[model samples]
Target: MKTAVSIPDRIFEAAEQYARRRGIPRSQVYAEALARFMAEQESDEELTEALNRVCAEVDTSLDEFGRAAARRVVLPASEW
Candidate 1:
């Protein structure tokens, strides 16, 4: 697919230099960067979904003792 997008001059120059150094086409550099970015986004979405599922199943409420213990863990002696 052919698409034109606006990018900063500095970034375009850097990508051009990188492609030239690697003996690859400019399109390949953009394609690989886009593919890697999409993969990272997908992984982040998966991680968020997993965290949501875990949060939904787990009890978040703290009993009095649990709250006290958490406070102790979070607070310094001077603050306590």
Candidate 2:
């Protein structure tokens, strides 16, 4: 696919230098960068979905003793 977009002159110069040094086209550099970015975004979504599923299956309620312990751990000053 062909597209056009704007970027900072400094970043363009750096990408140009990188492509020139590696003897690869500028398009490949941009394509690889976009691919890595998309992969990371997808991985983050997958991690969030997996965490939600695990949280849904576990017990989240606290008993009286557990609540007291949690309060002491959180506040540590007031009498229970």
Candidate 3:
């Protein structure tokens, strides 16, 4: 599919250089980049949905002792 989109000059120059170095068409570079980006976004959405489903199914909460342990583990990290 052919499409027109605006991009920064620096990005365009870098993509042109990359295509020349790899001996691939500019369109192929853009297409591959777009494909990878779309896959990453899809994976993120799937992970979020899975987490939500698990949280909904599991009716649980930390006891005071468990919460204290968690707080101990996290307090040191917050200082950094």
Evaluate all candidate structures by whole-model CA lDDT and list the values in order: 0.95, 0.94, 0.95
Q: Could you tell me the lDDT of residue 48 within candidate 3?
A: 100
Tell me which of candidates 1 and 2 scores higher on TM-score: 1
For residues 3-38, write the lDDT of model 1, one tens digit per residue: 999999999999999999999999999999999999
Measured over all alpha carbons after superposition, the RMSD of each candidate to the real structure, in angstroms, is 4.0, 4.9, 3.0
Clashes of each: 0, 0, 0
Positional deviation of residue 9's Cα in model 1 after best superposition, in angstroms:
0.7
Q: How accurate locally is residue 32 in candidate 2, as Cα lDDT from 0 to 100?
A: 95
Please, what are the lDDT tens digits per residue for candidate 2 over residues 1-80?
99999999998999999999999999999999999999999999999999999989998788998999988786687567
The TM-score ranking, best first, is 1, 3, 2
For 19-77, candidate 3 gives per-residue lDDT tens digits of 99999999999999999999999999999999999999996698998889888997767
Candidate 1 overall lDDT versus native: 0.95
Off by over 4 Å in 1: 65-80
Q: Report lDDT (Cα) of residue 43, candidate 1.
A: 100
